[model samples]
Target: MYLHLTGTHLRLLGSMHLFPTTSRRTPPWIAEAYDWADTLVFESDPPTILPLLSANEQGSADRLRPFLPPDAWQHLNAVWPAGGSLAPLAGLRPWAAMIVAPTLFQQVVEGVEPRLLRSALTQGKPYQYLETAEEVAASLDTIPLDAIGAALALLMTDLAEPQRTLERMHAAWLEGDLPAIHRIALESPMFNLPGIREAILDARNRAWAARLTSLLARPERTLVVVGALHLCGPNNLLDCLAHPFEPVPDDAA
Candidate 1:
């Protein structure tokens, strides 16, 4: 989805982190926004958050297994036949595992955030992150162990469904069907867990909105690319923005 500040050279893009390689071409609107902006913004920096994603102790798979249902562990291995990506799980907290599982879908090209970051570096466009690594870690720490176990159980059960869900989400994202993206995403096992929706989505949206309000005072033409959910669903970032902005089909007027 696309949004423009009602009366300034500011733009917002509801970014899908990953897309199927078959559709590897960048969307026109995204390129337009990238070209228009003097600076860009994203959710958080990945490398800075890597440490927080790891557990204090190693052998996370062995440690996590006791808490997970037997069938879920069986299914997790079944889904991860190679154990290439699975190795990362051995040291990750459940919440971190959830974040890492996005590639479980299949045949995804590089995620848009990384691609844009690379471009920003190559072309000399300055950029910034909405949340620091510490902030992201704090948000994730809200997840209790019991909820993690429940989420892992559902994540393993019928992995095929998650694959299909990702495809459906990608399609909706390409079509700019904001409502469809929000509905499909919220249906995930993680979101359904107690208190997770607030911890992961709503609270972050509020925090991002506050950061973005200050950003509005900057003179640079800007493009902010955050997750699609942050721009769509109820209690979304756009709605929380203290400054007025409106969706625009093209460039900001």
Candidate 2:
């Protein structure tokens, strides 16, 4: 799941998280650019190419393997960077940076320690939980009218479960539930234009676009990395480009 934050807010948040840690394992580029930037942009679908060095040196798998899922590792093998060695990061130099969305946080947490979930649950009722197919089918049973008052109370308060709802929507999206995301969002009164997940994505795109627009106007060289999807569609940076860029066919390789 992507941690959506405003560009400026993201920089501030990332800085706070990194300040006390001295671990040097992950590439320095992430923290370096993140800290120095006037804006820190995040995307729902950030690019995530594997580090070739990590793959080639089989011994490093014990360390790197923990960070990626098995499926991602398989893909890494298929695209293992060769010859040029550091070709995976070519064109991206000292100042150029890339950001990957936070996808495996849940999986990593669950895999490492099942207790994390129990702890979160102990806090209170989880904001929301998805109805399984069995649960959906079971809805055929009628609800007692007595529970309706409590349900309506939840809809009116800030204490109403939001994190649970967000998780459900995220799960739905990941499972190819395009309609479910929209359905859940529309059904919940708590989520809306300025505060909903979609609104957060929209704000993130506009924030990064404005930053790039200002920087590109200068003579300085800048490389802003965002999700591949954001760069391709009608709302893409390509549309905003003054010069045209041709598409390179995948088969041409």
Candidate 3:
């Protein structure tokens, strides 16, 4: 969910469902702020639900575009003058290389899937408590029944808003709306699963904190791309920084 961006100009998109974080429209001051930062870092995480493409025999870069946001297409088209003004706003001409960490990829591929899993204890039998991973694993004959059971217990509750927030994040990014992106991050549904939500939040906070620590060590001002969700909660990345920076609100977009 973190990235290292080095260039004269940069645009980073953070997304979470739908909410207006900025004033009501894109503000000129935000663009001016980017000009002052010198190094533009975007902290965001792409949603993991997007499917990965199967590798080709030659492996000539298969496109996972379909699994990406609809706005990416627009942004790609806007790089030119008539389409939009991202180039001027960035101040960096052709743009430098963009670095991204597919954190969501790791989470989705490695995380457990609860609905598809089956319990070994007869379906009709009622078992109230399924606490630990091993207890769930013992009840089934699968790759990792316990893990899936535990993960499902967390992912199944109130996921609609989180997922939508992710989608909205992508949309705002494509449209070059950082403020709107921030709104989505702050207002997305509460991730309050008994055994899962807090764990996920804590894990995310550690990951982002680590990134900030590393960035603080680096001399170059770099732009970081990560998930919008990582920006909120108690220990937010911006909050952890030694220096000061302002969050672009959704209304500004």
Best lDDT among the predictions, by candidate number = 1
Query: Higher-lDDT candidate among 2 and 3?
Result: 3
Model 2 lDDT per residue over 1-253, tens place:
1222222122111111111122213233333433333332222111122232222222222233343455543444344344343444222211111111112111211210122223334653222111222222123112222222222223324322444454565455344344465567555542332232222233344444555445444332222334332333233344443333332222321
Give the least accurate 10-residue stretch of model 2, judged by summed lDDT.
Answer: 11-20
**Which residue runs of candidate 3 sit more than 4 Å off their true CA positions?**
1-190, 248-253
Q: Candidate 3 versus the native: TM-score?
A: 0.32
Instruction: Compare candidates 1 and 2 on TM-score and give the better one.
Output: 1
TM-score, candidate 2, is 0.24
Number of the top candidate by TM-score? 1
The global C-alpha lDDT for each of the candidates, from Candidate 1 onward, is 0.76, 0.31, 0.34
- How far residue 168's Cα lies from its native spot in candidate 1, in Å, is 1.0
For residues 1-253, what per-residue lDDT tens digits would candidate 1 score against the true structure?
A: 8788777666788987877766777777777778788999999998898777767543344466776898887766565535443455656666776656545756777667888899999998999889999898788777766777777777676556666777788889889899998889778876777767778888899998888877776789989999887877778887888567767665542
| Model 1 lDDT on a 0 to 1 scale | 0.76
**Winner by lDDT between candidate 2 and candidate 1:** 1
